[model samples]
Target: MKSLQKLATIALAIILMGSCTAQEEATTLKDALKDYFYIGTALNVPQVAGQDPQAIEIVKTHFNSVVAENCMKMMYLQPEEGVFFWDEADAFIEFAEANDMQVIGHTLVWHSQAPRWMFVDENGDQVSRERLIERMKTHVQTVVERYKGRVHGWDVVNETILDDGSWRQSPWVRIIGPEFVQMAFEFAHEIDPDVELYYNDYSVSRPEKRDGIYNMVKDLIDNGVKIDAVGLQGHLSMDFPTVEMKEEALQKLASLGVKVMVTEMDITVLPWPSRRHSAEVSLNYEISDEYNPYPNGLSEESYTALMDKYVDFFEMFMRNKDIISRVTVWGVDDNQSWRNNWPIRGRTDYPLLFDRDYQPKSAVTRIIELANAKKQ
Candidate 1:
């Protein structure tokens, strides 16, 4: 009886060891990032106190590439004229380089998030067209020269086209006019001939927006603009954007010889307010109002729906890998998502693959399942 008990103990130990091994080999978010396709998240220097080793751990474990700083641009890189802030970006780039991760520079020129002094004159009015172009060229050169080969690619222009295929009435258009995007790409190429340049924007799934970006890229490429790719900032919602629209957008962009990327992807559960009803229209339905609770936050069902929505998009991404190059979730987890504000205003939104505690949610599991489907 004693001998039998000893054998049973040995068998239990073996089983426990096997379980541990399986857990250790479990695919991480980083593993999913590297194995099937690119996965990424944004980093805020101030929030991380510039010692974000966890960010590196995430990339090392999951991702092959990352979109760095709004780096290589006006807002974060050169917050003040000729005053470069390399302290944070320097650490991030070095971290990525040492860890064998590729970094994509966010933007050289954009309507939003740029330093106030960039477009405005000493009088605080729009600068002249020629003056704006020179400023843009200077900003682009200073940034691209600093990071030339270290960063892999850049969003030379961002959000220049509106959802309805019209040009946004940005101060950029008022000052630099239509030449802003073209000159931005030109300046990037001048600095680093090898680094790819792309035009990036949100709402690529909308037919009008997709067609508009396609036309814009076609013209830029035709005009010798060295534009190598287009970034589809896939900030999706619970249900509106049909996957058919997304697939069509990819094929259309691919047809133009430009690579497409699902940049800034986060599907918010907060019910996307119906375009049919104006913003002034108060939420009458209980489901819509609770999902988009004005003062407090998202309901529990809204949070679950958000995760399921992300899974659906990843499933679509799996099916359409040929045209998609990089897939970046804007933030790492729920607490960090932009959906907390902006649209929903004062809502506790859960939008990414990880929950607020940094635990991988079912969204992460579904992503892995979709990515590993072929192996199964």
Candidate 2:
């Protein structure tokens, strides 16, 4: 009887050891793909300050890189002309340094979230090209110079091109003409030559926008601009941006001889407000059941579909990993995702790898498995 009890205890210990080994092997996204490329998510004020314990742990465990979701933007950093707010931005850098994680400054120039003071005079008239250029230099240099060697990269200019293969006609374009993009890149490089400068935009998988980005980057390089990378905001939606389209787009972006990064990626499993798949914040639709079909939660079938979509996208990222330097999800999980009220308000959308409960969904394991399988 004593010998039988000992055998049972030893068998139970062996099973426990096997489970521990498996858990250790594939615990987090950062660990799973540490050898491939950097994986990251955007960090908000709460997460940066350790106000949200769950989010802090999630970020520490699953990601090796982070981008400021909003605090580093022009509006947040410098609400006034010369008054730069460094509290939140400084805290972000401190947190990143403490954790040994890389940080990416969201943007130095963008049409959206740009302070109106920089574009207009006290009399409410638009600033001249020279005036606007000076302002741009001041903002870009102050921000970039402050964080020199601390950040991995900066999205120098964002969303300069439109979906129709034309310029977006932003104030920068109206005031400084098309040269603002190059100027932003140059100003950043002037401050920190070692930092990577990226021109980030969304809807890159659409043929028109993709071609526009390609043409623009090609022009910049031809003109001897110091641009380093192209960041495609991978705000993917279900049934849009087919894998074939992404492959072609990735190859085209890489052909420019600049590294490619899938920045701000998130897969929206919800139905679109319109047929248009865009990240434009101005676009909004009235709330309706048709648009918010999954208010309760995602169906089993839909969840599986979402998982499959994630696997497909990760496979593509891995396929182009040589040219791809980093792949960052836009948010940590469903609850924190901006998709909650984007385009259509008051909707529950399960678009990320983790659910609302902070439990990683099926795609986490599947993605890690896919990466390991490729290695094997």
Candidate 3:
């Protein structure tokens, strides 16, 4: 009887040891880049609400930081004047906090997606410049104060500078002039001095746009404003903005003595609407078969090309890890990526590290291998 008991104990011990080994073998993206910088992903409404178990699991396993894909946007957060919706945004913050992930508040101010009421009056005319400035002040202070110390960083301003090294004629720019960008940053700092402030924009690798952004940030710093970082929205493609261009942009931004972050990164494996390099391109076209190239699924050739592009970009990022603070993929998976519906609607695009089935692509493995090599 004593011998039987001893054998059972031995079997239990072996099983426990095997379980421990399996757990340790679960190397994640966050773990791979732990010593270098944060690996992050943007979470949509469904994932933040716990409706998408597979996406949530992927985020938990691979990422150490979280940004809301839409919940925290000004339009969604404040649909009407003087009325702010906090349900989804609150849940998003809670989810990130529960997961022990750093939270990034995406876009306190942007030209697009903002409510029309903000720029127009009851008679459908643009509000007075004074009125607009006050409204912006209230909006920035209210949102930043609500989250206070919970959010570690904020994309305080977004896409204000055009690609031609001039300010975009956005409503904010038109009403409050170029100083609106400065005002937004100042308000955020006044509300929470600890929160890191960032100016985020797409197509930042283009020379003209890079110069414009650098000058804007440099001017703000010269004026005694606290600009912590510049977020280069890495909505890249397979062909444009070569590695050298991206490196030059990063080097210039870092030279200004401000931290850099690769925010909203995704490599689109699809055709472009036009020759423009901007990801904000939103040309609408009637549904057609030609536009949907990968209707069935991505061929092995296309898959390999996509993986190569991702690995190449990751290599560049690792090379400049000193200036780049965090690297965030725009969505959790290809199925949820904004590329599927933007510029051309209903077109399937594989632009993230995970497939629609929640499986990590070949690029994820290659990226992990690259990061591990650096450690060694």
lDDT of 1 by residue, 1-376 (tens): 9999999999999999978865655376556545456777665554335454554455456566776534445688878877878877776677678767778888788877789888778998877888878888888898888887898888888888877887877888876677777888888898899998899887777788889888888988899889887888877766657677777888898899888888887776665645631111123432344655533544668666776677777777766777777888787667666667645455667777666666677777777756655434
Q: What ranges in model 2 sit over 4 Å off?
A: 1-24
- Writing each residue's lDDT as its tens digit, candidate 2 over 7-116 gives 99999999999788666675578877877789989989988888788888888888999999999999999999999999999999998888999899998899899887
Candidate 3 TM-score, true structure as reference? 0.92
Model 3's C-alpha root-mean-square deviation from the true structure amounts to 5.7
- Pairs clashing within candidate 1: 30-61, 30-62, 31-62
Looking at candidate 1, the ten consecutive residues that score lowest on lDDT are 277-286
The numbered model that scores best in TM-score is: 2
lDDT winner: 3
- Mind sharing the TM-score for model 1? 0.83
Better of 2 and 3 by lDDT: 3
Q: Better model by lDDT, 1 or 3?
A: 3
Ranking by lDDT: 3, 2, 1
Q: How many residue pairs clash in each candidate?
A: 3, 0, 0
Inter-residue clash pairs, candidate 2: none
Candidate 3: tens digits of C-alpha lDDT, residues 39-64: 89999998887899999999999999
Task: For each candidate in the order shown, give its overall lDDT on alpha carbons.
Answer: 0.73, 0.88, 0.90
